[model samples]
Target: MTLDPSVVTAFTPTGKLRASINLGNPVLAKRDPVSGEPCGVSVDLARAFAERLSVDLELVAFDTAGKSVEAVSDERADIGFFAVDPLRAQAISFTAPYVLIEGFYLVRDDSPITRNQDVDQPHNRVAVGKGSAYDLFLTREIKTAQIVRAPTSPAVVQTFIEQNLEVAAGVKQQLESDASRFSGLRLLDERFMVIQQAMGTPKSRGLAAATALQRFVEAMKTSGFVSAALERHGIAGASVAPAA
Candidate 1:
């Protein structure tokens, strides 16, 4: 793919393409248990983008999506992987989502809320990661239940357990992993939301860069690169998003 020179400049101002890797979204990026390096579908995508640009790949790691968004907004990173959230769109321009991950609620096995619909009630506190897609979504959609913000997505499970929250909202895979690690935690079978994971560049990067990224992402999805990366990384519970 021949990229416009300006697009390259917009995405690699420091001569290296710094991609923000948010470990908070475990489905997208995670720490390799053996190597302690960032690894996952998002990491693979970032590496692929860098190679396509013929630039060095720099992983700018963060613990939360908000921080990753902030990095791109601040021009500290060239691109970031994010769940398409309207609140975040002001600072960054996003490609159509390349992956879809479900968002679910985790509640105690013995809790009264057995169904997803039971989560919303007066006095029911839902623990969520502050500035997360779910947090932003729930902040708007949830009319009755109160939301308690955790420091990060990975921290939500612990916050739920420690604080005895009525519901814990996060990525389904994450809640499943947490349920296995912590007994008595059960995820609602029904999902409340689908997270649209996409790549983003600072809006200030200009239209050329944005268009280039969108094309790159769609091509990656259409050609099966994103699916291959997910399988290679053993990622579960996420599907390749259809073309925009």
Candidate 2:
């Protein structure tokens, strides 16, 4: 079967890459908001995988990271990039995390919420991508603040910039890229989750596929290919675990 040279996105701005890439406009394109390109660490990792796969990276952008999983589950792309969790494990397998991400509270940089406790104030609102690890984390941590669920990381950034919300929750890398746009927006250093970045395959084929995917990830980690890929993408601080 011929490989389909196509890309699909779940967000609006459509993340762009430098190489000969197939672009899929999704609802969530995390940007500098000022630079207007793919700015998150996730984008970097995804592009690196595309390069390694030797196929034109087909990014199926989603308004939120949660929606991106659908693309992988549907077989639209060979895999997807996201923070892995047990709930997602039931749907897809993940690669070893490349970066150590901690939970952060995003708010206007000038706001008094420079710390975690500040966000617990009544009437404080925080935004999160629906079904994202951050979203899952926030639902557990920030029960006091009203939660605004955005479709994509970019949209959540936009909402904060547009003054539609009070705070946001996500990884530091993503929040940092987005905060660069709204200088007024800043990330609170208090982190919550210990997430590892991994690729996912649909849980449909049962143990064989799951086993295969896990092995592929393990091989990538052990062979140092995964580290090389992360470095190529400008994502540092990731090391692969030995295959068990």
Candidate 1 per-residue lDDT over residues 1-244, each given as its tens digit? 8997778988898999999999998888989999999998999999999999999999999999888889998999999999998888998999999999999999888888888788889979999998889999999999998999999999999999899788999999888887788877788889999999999999999999999999999999999999999999888889999998
Residue-level lDDT tens digits of model 2 in 1-244: 1112232122111243212111221211244457666644446545754454344555455555566766666555556666677766766766565445566677775677777778876789887767777777667777678888776555677776566688887666667767786656666776756656565655553455445445555655676766665566555433444455
Best by TM-score: 1
Over 4 Å off, model 1: none
At residue 1, give the lDDT of candidate 2: 16
Candidate 1 global lDDT: 0.92
Task: Give the CA lDDT, 0 to 100, for residue 202 in model 1.
Answer: 92
| Poorest stretch of ten by lDDT in candidate 2 | 18-27
Residue 10, model 1, lDDT: 82
| Best model per lDDT | 1
lDDT of each: 0.92, 0.58
Off by over 4 Å in 2: 1-63, 75-78, 95-99, 236-244
